[model samples]
Target: MTNIAELRKQINYHLYRYYALDDPIISDAEFDQLMQTLRDLEAQNPELITPDSPTQRVGAEPLESFDKVTHVVAMTSLANAFNDEDMRNWLGRIERRLPTWYPRDAVEFVVEPKIDGLAVAIVYEQGLLKQGATRGNGLVGENITANVRTIKSVPLRIPATPDGPPPPTRIEIRGEVYMPIKEFNRYNQQQLDLGERVFANPRNAAAGSLRQLDSRETASRPLAMFGYGVGYIEGAELQTHWDALEYLKAVGFPVNPDIIRTKNFDEVLEFIRQWMDKRDELGYDADGAVIKINDLTLQKYLGLVGNAPRWAIAYKFPAREATTKLLEIRCNVGRTGQVTPYAVLEAVNIGGVTVRQATLHNFEDLAKKDIRPGDTVLLKRAGDVIPQVVKPILEARAADSMPYQPPTHCPDCHEALSHFGEEVALFCINAACPAQLVRQLEYFVSRPALNIEGFGVKISEQVAQAGLIHDVADIYTLTKTQLLSLEGFAEKKADKILAMIDESKHQPFDRVLTGLGIRYVGSVVAAFIAHAFADIQALQQATQPELEQINGIGPRIAESIVDWFSRPANRTLVQKLRQAGVTLSSSKVEPTAPQTLANLTFVITGTLPTWGREEAAAFIQDHGGKVTGTVSKKTDYLVAGEAAGSKLEKAQTLNIPIIDEAGLKKLATE
Candidate 1:
């Protein structure tokens, strides 16, 4: 192979490992270095860069509108099974249609998650991605090739694993493109902070992200694909559904890892039952589990019942909804000072949980829904999200009830509220708003923030309401006797809380910044700002341009930081925190540790004997070494302990040195 071709192959292999398989044998820096080299090589020899090159996934020119795609094989739907009986009925139908030669007991089934996402069909020609489209009308769909190309999980070239299955001449794969629930939440909050309208759920977020006209916009979203089945193929024949999924996985597609192939019907139901209860644990949202006849030939024989396939069925989870009376409309002032509306509902059971309240989302959504007190509202509890008011039963509204109004003032402080530019959320701009401060206090002690152990939310609210603490900074100045005077505080509990508060004062500046509850400044973003600015004084003095220049510090975060520091009351609070002996700079003012492992890079995996992963990473950084997520040839050492899985194996493969916790400490102190 030519040098350029081999280089591109190597890059594609690493990309497959990193994106498709979620395992990497290279550090991010090494991967970046490889990409940079390829970019330079392509610049030197422009014609060498093909459309399937790793460098060519993004930067497609924007189209006025998406083109249409007519499917060679229709993207058919599946009938749904709400319970075991429904699933049994489907199996019975399949049994009745089965040829006499094919025994019913010999039938095998493949059960996979029915991802609550956008259904898409992607085509491949000569192992390279040809085109991708949304499942528009079964036989026809919108061409979203440009947008799909940007999804890293959707491989540009097939057979991601070396020496895997050879490419088919042409193949059509069907999959669901989805956003992880956690990523969706974070992305939605970021959008809201940037004054953009946010998606109500992960499924909507994935769909909206995948359908963006600009490919770069799609690239920026965290979209992933899981191949479920095949629509059409030439030069390849698959006999079983399980084999098809396996073939898809071998050829660079990420299939659902939880797919189970079983001959027993009871096993299928058991898998579905387990998944229903554990739905929240799946990183991505799934509305149901799909059961398919494993034999492909049998599927073809027992096919086409209306728009749905007769051989497959979706076992949908019970819907989480209940009709509850809207007792009242309430407003809550959040830490960022956004006053959001919520519903005070009469106690109703939704999905086994007695939900007393539901999120109205924001004032704009409330106005759009026209939900009023005394109306019966349909509540939906989706996984871990706060139960939401889907819609009100307009016919069930009381004659005396009037349309609910969004709060005109801050609910707690009665301060005048205002809209932020074109944003829908109303903000209480009062710096000393008591309700906002209580939320700030609650957040300041959260596990991801300062981590004031034993300092619970109820106590934070109690102290704030009792006039013991005015702001988060005042937490450091709280007296033991004052805490003991509270409802739940005993002498022992009060002392422990005081000690935790003192310990929190020693928390790094990033944690302190996170605890401050600045708008758009999440813990991860706060860390970037803290590292870039070094000290509270430097951060306070940083202009919008200076803050925005830092990596990952966006305009919204920069503006929020600048606006936060501009307030005199906030400045005074910072001074109070500093006076209370909080470490405000990047690190404590002290002598530096020995730079023993200055030039070294390390990878940590599994449970360490004497140190946790974070602790070991901190120790390495204390002596000036870098720690990365993956093992690579460039990695100086692998700090490993019991059950160090793939990273250990990769390190061994590359002949990289391995060290235990003791050896790691020894090297750090050398």
Candidate 2:
């Protein structure tokens, strides 16, 4: 039998690789096998399970409230330097405070991106994570150890590597916890698809995700950390700030790889300029560049002025906001019947981009902001993406302005708008509403759905306006002659679009399900439903409870699925799609081969070399295996590929066997 301690060490190392370094040596399935063995051993010998074991990352109950924790060393804020003049002035101030022995111009400094996130201090005692707290008021914070442990990048135990330095008696690692931009966008999209309020920006999303009372919820969120500095340290001798960062990295903390050490302030200025132009390229949000004195002794000598450090300054990028007057507020109904309120703004230049309109998010947010017509509003364009109205400048509000009211009728179709139970936004529930039909057609041809080439938002709108395509099924009825009649539809373009539309008929049933625009049934959920039922007919016949029994399908999603199929129009559309020769079932027919993986469960993650996750999962199911979204003791294998995240970590910790595409193929043959 494998030693439990050795298994734990191996799992932690792989986690550090997958999370901290963004690299993994083994597939998820192989890792799960290791975890399962360890779990079996620990289950049989309960005393062998330790706090630092990987299994302890999750499974904590929700807390009613957090307890206050006082910091040994205050997590101070940094002084701001907006320009070269400000930087020079700050350097001069630091020089004046330094002793004569320290050469002012020769002092080394470290420059790193100032992450826009929540600051938290992680305390490690005897090499294990002891406590984690937020930097509330800089002096004291709420203890969030359980939630922090759920962050895969944050190691539960320090000195995780065998060759690493001995355990520190105690240390407080201070870092910013943030959600990567990609993950934030994905999460916000999920929220929108579910008819929930979306986060305004990544920073807000990170803060909200971190402060969840349920650690399980936090674990579900894609949160990561980058250690920048230490709050307190005992037992270790750190000579300089750079040395401390190196020590943190050696002990399994992820430090930003873009950090640079330089003695020249000119280089620092250049670095800041480069980052200002390239910050969007980074995975996480960065609002500024932090320049700190590299020497620990010099930092101590030039320490605290008020609450900010004298030896360090943050060179903030110019604000991406512009003040504009709210001309009016209007609502737009989406294909899914979701109604969103937006602000019509007097044109203002934000980050060199002209902003004519901004999103107000929803009616609830609009009422909360108390924004009215003729009020001055702050509009921000973070990363030059979508522009959003921050808030109304109450002082600049028109004296006669009244509180804005949500529309009682659909903006486009003029039908009565209705709000769903427990939902914030109003919806235009009429399926035949022209606006809804147009948007729904657009979604049907979207990349994640049927992926009809040459079919874009403008094209979908034109086709709908011409009465060529009213519903997703009507798309197959379009003729090249009808397309050529529309503006901008030449012979070549029309022919190409017709060909693409024909090509989409072969799109798998899962994507067809997604293209149906069922509420809360995005690609992930659609795939689960498609796999569970094998065919659209089976899915349509499934009861709400039967749908909910699928791993990823919750009560709300199951209800949505059942409600959608219950409608006569939807059933007819599915029938039309089938009549049009569209694939309405799994492409892989039930295999006659021996059920090699019978009664076994597998979880798939990341991108495979030759097959997509869905393709690989379909193969497993065809061979009599079950696929689930999460890894657990019940999971027999985890099919992992490149860039696997939390699932990979969890599999490794549980000692579950992991396999790659090749390994999976081998298992299928056996």
Candidate 3:
């Protein structure tokens, strides 16, 4: 009597809308309430749970060749230990043997949500991230170093320990990289808008995104990773997984904060139960719980069994799976120079929001799902943010399904794109291209740029189209009527814009330099450049010899600086800017005294008592001391302030001198 067919159809339609469309009509709480009711009904009547039901299993055929990778140290998957009885039995088995296995010395167990994603091993040599690979049966994996490099959270260069020792001379770290629900949603939405196929869930999305042939593509997807275990470390020592996570964070990798250390197995169960109930709140999909012996030494004693690690276990969450059609495939380009591919869905609703799109990452992704524009696909939402396409239903594919193509040119600017030999991004190198110019102009006129209030993108475009302003400096000379004539610019708005332009003249010399769109010249570098040269004219006239003396300005940036100034048009543009009354001089005096805080590197910790961090740093730089972020033996002093955290302990451990507000003031005077 249960109308399973009708209910299945209704649920499928709603799922498609939520996961594919991104526009949802129902509240998450309401949707979950309905889903719970349906699940309970299905459980009561097992015959009613159909393949098409929302509670169905995640579908995807296994892949063929995961490129063979030899981990510096083998990357192993964790063995499973589910439920209280299973956990206690394993703990007894471990305690029955090992010499260092006393209950009190057991320390606390580290419990984390078993993030459902691909396992990868990252190797760092001498504090530099060198390689990353997947766990292909634990002993070997496919090298994905390049793709892993695209993850911004993964530090390219590890921060040196405060104790004057670099990070382990050789270290192999194991972790899981995942896609957050919010980023996945945005990624899928972008794909949907571009008419691409969508990903089904967070796990699939993360796996598919990470395995990309083009690491660059893998890098662009909203993929995040957390270091959960260590494979091998030389020189440096960590006692527990919690400490390892902290160390990873210190070295610039983002670690999940939800990881907890509990003294008892009941506490672990409570943590799991609590998290399972609150699973929808996590940004990434967690299938189960990952329970590990917190102590690294304990982990070593209980080491490898087959392809799994004996020290840890994964308790996966109940799976939520759904099937939908892969309507189309598309690509998106962001402001930060990343091109992401996504899928346009047949309008599914997963979680509370309607999903119409899912990200594909790049050209390399198209091959992974074997995803064609018109194929039926299965999907799942891990933490309810990203919709990942699992695999194409080959048997269900329409005859018209075809492979997707990558664009040869920049969609925003018609310029021919060029890919750097070292990078996967095909850059539109023409800085003067309409789109790049427009973006740069927008940035230049931003509060941090020229600080012109009324000069927004649309206004800038109007000016560009009208041929009134070709360069950033031209914005300073626009007539009030010229702006007033544009679509949204009224007399008052135009006057306001003009006044903002006038105000921009007073922006510091460093801000003006940054607004010029010099390659690799950000705000901090701009400040350095301003301080390096006494004025704009001096910077322009300075030889490479003089320019190379500034710290952080390497050969490439130095070359770029010289080339920028050498261009006749650029010189003429500067002259025009000067004519327009832009200030290109700094008021700060250069300290010429020997040993006046010279060569003394200081690290600023937490919020300053009386000054903004930057202001405090500027105070140090003005007095000839360099301000760095982390504590190190190279650091002359640690300026500790209110709410100081790990860096404080690091300074203490390394015996680096710690200074307070009064001490900083004294140093400045000395």
- Residue 48 lDDT in candidate 1: 77
Model 2, runs deviating above 4 Å: 1-14, 23-59, 160-163, 591-670
Query: Residue-wise lDDT of candidate 1 within 1-670, one digit each (tens)?
Result: 1398888889989988887788999999999888876775675467777988989876488889989999899888888899999999998898889999899889999999888999999999998899999999888999999999988888888876787799999999999999988888878666654445667778878989888888888887888889998888899999889888989988878888899999999999999999999887898887899999999899889978998999899999988889989999999777778877788999999867899988887778888889988899999877666688999998888889788888788899999999988877888989889888887888889888899988777987898999988878888878988988889788999888899999988889899898887777878888776655546886797778666656578787789889889888899999999999987876722237787877687877766777866578767766766565656676899998875666778999999999999999888787
Q: What's the number of clashes in each of the models?
A: 0, 20, 59
How does each model score on lDDT? 0.84, 0.86, 0.69
Off by over 4 Å in 1: 1-64, 83-89, 99-106, 150-152, 185-198, 214-222, 266-284, 588-670
Better of 1 and 2 by TM-score: 2
TM-score of 1: 0.78
For candidate 3, write residues 1-670 as lDDT tens digits.
Answer: 3465555545544443343333456777777656755664564466666533555422223334346777667666667765677777877766676674355555568888877778888888886677778887767688777667666445554552222245779888778888877887777655543224457566778889878765545645877777776777898888888888877755545567788898787888889888888888887777788888888877777777777777777776655556688776765544333445678899887645577887565666667667887788777665655566767778897787677666677776666777655655456555455655566677788766677876787887788777787777788778987887778778888888788889888888899998886766767678888755546886787677555656557676787789888877679879988999887755453445333665677777765679765566666666766665556666789988765667778999999999987788788787
Instruction: State the lDDT of candidate 2 residue by residue for 339-399, as single tens digits.
Output: 8899898999977778899989888888988888889998887762468999999888878
Residue range with the least summed lDDT across 10 consecutive positions in model 3 = 56-65
Per-prediction TM-score, please?
A: 0.78, 0.84, 0.49
Between candidates 1 and 3, name the one with more favorable TM-score.
1
Using lDDT as the measure, name the better of candidate 1 and candidate 2.
2
RMSD in order of candidates: 10.2, 7.1, 19.8
